[model samples]
Target: MDRSSPAGNPLPAADRADGGREECASEVKAKLVGAKRWRRLRRLLAGVVVLGLTGWFALPWVMPWPAALSRPVPAGMRITDVHGTSLRRLLAGGMRAETPPKLPEIPKALVLATLAAEDHRFYRHGGIDPVAVARAARDGVSAGRRVSGASTITQQLVKLTVPRARTLRTKGLEMLTARRVEMIWSKDQILEQYLQRLDYGNLHLGPAAAAAGYFGKPLADCSLAECAFLAGLPQSPSRLNPWRHADRAVKRQQWVLNRLGVLGWADADSLARARAEPLKLRRHYGFFMAPHFVDLLLSSLPETSRAGGENLTTTLDLDIQRTAERAVASHLARLAGKNVTQAAVVVLENSTGNVLALIGSRDYGAADGGQVNGAVARRSPGSALKP
Candidate 1:
């Protein structure tokens, strides 16, 4: 029952059907393998997405809070005169700025200026500003590099507390920590903390110190111009230092004032006046009188009290100390030709045994054993002490 084709031998329909069946089986197997591979790829992608979501939700809780926030602020003890005038500032560590003021004590103008200069949307944002971020991203893309920043005040505080190199990983951690900080602290508390730890030029740590050191006044007494001047310093303290680079500082201040005017925080008259007002920047190295006496008093105290937060008021009077210093200097000048290289003056009150003045040497700043406590040193009493 075989039939012959035109150019072939006899062919059977059953063989042709068997060959067709084999081809069909091959196509089905290939399709099944492709489907299995697609399923495996989808599973892998789903696992990655799940892991990413889990990490995003759990990062803040897993990351530890910054230790610097919990640690006590490093403060120094103060030594004052009987009239409560500061005679010397003694710090166990590096030099610190003046004590920071509370939120209420901070000046309104300064706050406004700071908000305008640093973060205009500080109150509205949680820890990041989406609008600013988008703008910065777009700008960066156009510039082919990072041209601007979008860090909120909260994010800046986090960065200050936990410093790290500039990288995507560090920035991600900073943003996460900033969110956590905002959740833990209120708006006022976060702002106050930021002001307390903010670095303002010349070792000044806070606005209080900046006011005192730069303006020779309290934070509450700072004028609008002064406030603007100080507000501009936190951007680049060293570069905009009022003492060192007044021109740059004034430019920055003008910028802040302009921002304030634009924000309607200050009227035109006030902004104009601030721009015209001259800042009387004071260069204060802090009161450093009665060095020898202060040394003795500190030596007598326990290490804890010397470096503690408490201020010590001594029985010494500042006026009498000045008088005694002048008298010693004049007398030493008179005896300059008599080989008298040193002199010690000690003034005591008759009513009380308190020391009115104690000068250890003619010049405490001299390099030749000037720090020797001559008043307390054992020496033969000359004719001046004759009975």
Candidate 2:
């Protein structure tokens, strides 16, 4: 239908031009709104598909962990027990190799403490924990780098087996291997391997050496408090060396106790007492484990030992070695200040020429000097032995 303005004549060209421009503007707004709606719908659909694919692809990588793990000791090598006090074989005993120590010598209380204190989700997560990963990611974002670790107990076991961490490449490889281990081995098997491969100086590997070191108790006979103490050591043995820093050792021990508390393994009263208690420093099993031959054999050993298939026989008459140490210590009071106040004794088999008994010193340590091997170390005879 034709419309007319108030003016009697047909509308002027300028009026017509104004009306056309308004119509054009309305059409442009409609097209722009339609385009925006279409774009938003596309974006929403894309997001859903992406999420679905991500979940599908991540299935293998983020699936639940395995149920069990198999033990991996060398095919025929027996897991030996060598705690010498009882009639049972001692961990470092000269006579017997070792069989595995039963799961928990002390209690679940102590073992859980160590696992929690060192790693809270050790058993619950896969080789690595996602919560830890998220935490690490947050730290990285805020600080421009990582502050926490993502490695799980299994990953640590893999790293532990590596024995060296020279590069990122090596670490990545260890994580890969740890994942494989988680797939194949049971949790107990992994735990056993970790215990077995653990570093416990002087060819004495595993918890056995560690138990022998701190408590003078065999791995199997470790008391509740003692196991907590020894298990706490590997986290930082040197820094918390009981002999060097009694305070550090005590703190670590308490930290372990606290770990027990976290796992609800320790009682409230015991936790409080352990935390408040002063360091009850004790001589480590250094002498008790090896007795007479400890210092001598250690001095003779090279910086690093190679544990190939070669069976090396030591030079010690177990009976005689025990006797010599007792004899020398008893005689110390009579011989305290003769410049040669400290004494060492060595016995050798006449036939095999094996240096058997080597009692380095009455005291476990040297004269405040940095680690002097008192046994193999021969102080000049001082003209004592008449020529």
Model number with the top TM-score: 1
Model 2 CA deviation exceeding 4 Å by range = 1-107, 143-145, 164-166, 200-204, 276-280, 284-387
- Model 2 CA lDDT for position 228: 72
Give lDDT tens digits, candidate 1, residues 1-387.
345656777667887677678989999999999999999999999998988666545566667799988865555687899999988866535655565578889999998999999889999987778888999999999999999999888888888889999999998888888877877889898888888778888887788778877887878999999999999999988899777789999999999999999999999999888899987888876678998888888889888676644678999999999999999989989999898999898889999999878999978789987999899988887897888
Q: Candidate 2 — worst ten consecutive residues by lDDT sum?
A: 74-83
Show how many residue pairs clash in every candidate, following the order shown. Answer: 0, 17
Q: Model 2, residue 199: what's the lDDT? A: 48
* Candidate that scores best on lDDT: 1
User: Model 1, clash count?
Assistant: 0
After superposition, candidate 1 runs with Cα above 4 Å error: 1-59, 301-304, 333-341, 349-353, 366-372, 377-387
Residues 109-162 of candidate 2: C-alpha lDDT, one tens digit per residue: 446656765667877765666788788889989998767767777877776655
